[model samples]
Target: MDKFDKKILSSLHENARISYAELARRVNLSAPAIADRIEKLERTGVITGYHAQIDPTKAGLPILCMIELTVKHLDYYVVLERIRNMPQVLECASITGTSGLMMKVAVDTMPSLQTLIAQLMQFGDTKTSIIIDMPVPPRMPQLLADD
Candidate 1:
């Protein structure tokens, strides 16, 4: 919530694997101070768990697609849960406008993509668009920072 906390968060967003000492080195604080600050950040929910940034193409997910879906006469949570359980599904979001749910899925090939789409049909009517390139990797939602 302070300047140093924002600095700690910014540094972590770039490299979550940094050690407390190393983070301290970058953030200009003592190792123990860094550790305590990080602990406080986590406890206060300013910092969450760290995660990996996977290379989806190399990880056998050569095809990445954005799926736009709309469901009828069903509880949204129920359908969302089913979509979450699908192996191909990577990310799912409920949004406004034309699409009710926006999801990202991976496939090895076009035939496999067809199968994935067919599976989604069991829950709702859907539209999909394959990703050709991403200019920027998705970043964490920038919260509590003017910078």
Candidate 2:
């Protein structure tokens, strides 16, 4: 991507709802050019789907926690598939550490969390931590190395 493309991505990352004309003004390109660039970025998979950031507490999921799971030797895929299908699991990832998998989940009540943990225990041992706050919430990374 060139300088214009980087600028477009930076602007879009901040506000996906920004209009093509506004993007053009910011990047000093024509509206059509900006649209074409964005389209290309999407087509190339550099730009995925847009989304809105929601408040989990206000969404009726007041409890937020992270679960670090160490799956059984043969149950990694099984555990992963089950967690992927769970609505309460906001994010799940395989990491290089003591835990084979890590997940961020939100639930309605403590009992719900307990139930979820019980289910996961069928596959492997788990370490869970309740999230009190996020000082640095999720945000986009720089488009370029120097950025």
lDDT of candidate 2 over 22-66, digit per residue (tens): 989999999999989999999999998999989999999999999
lDDT of 1 by residue, 45-129 (tens): 8787998889889998899999998876566788878888898888988888877889998889999999988987877789999
What residue pairs are clashing in model 2?
none
Q: Rate the local accuracy (lDDT) of all candidates.
A: 0.86, 0.92
In candidate 2, how many Å is residue 78 off? Answer: 1.3
Task: Write down the TM-score for model 2.
Answer: 0.94
User: Worst ten-residue run, lDDT, model 2?
Assistant: 138-147
Clashing pairs in 1: none
Candidate 2 — which residues are off by over 4 angstroms?
145-147
Against the true structure, candidate 1 reaches a TM-score of 0.91
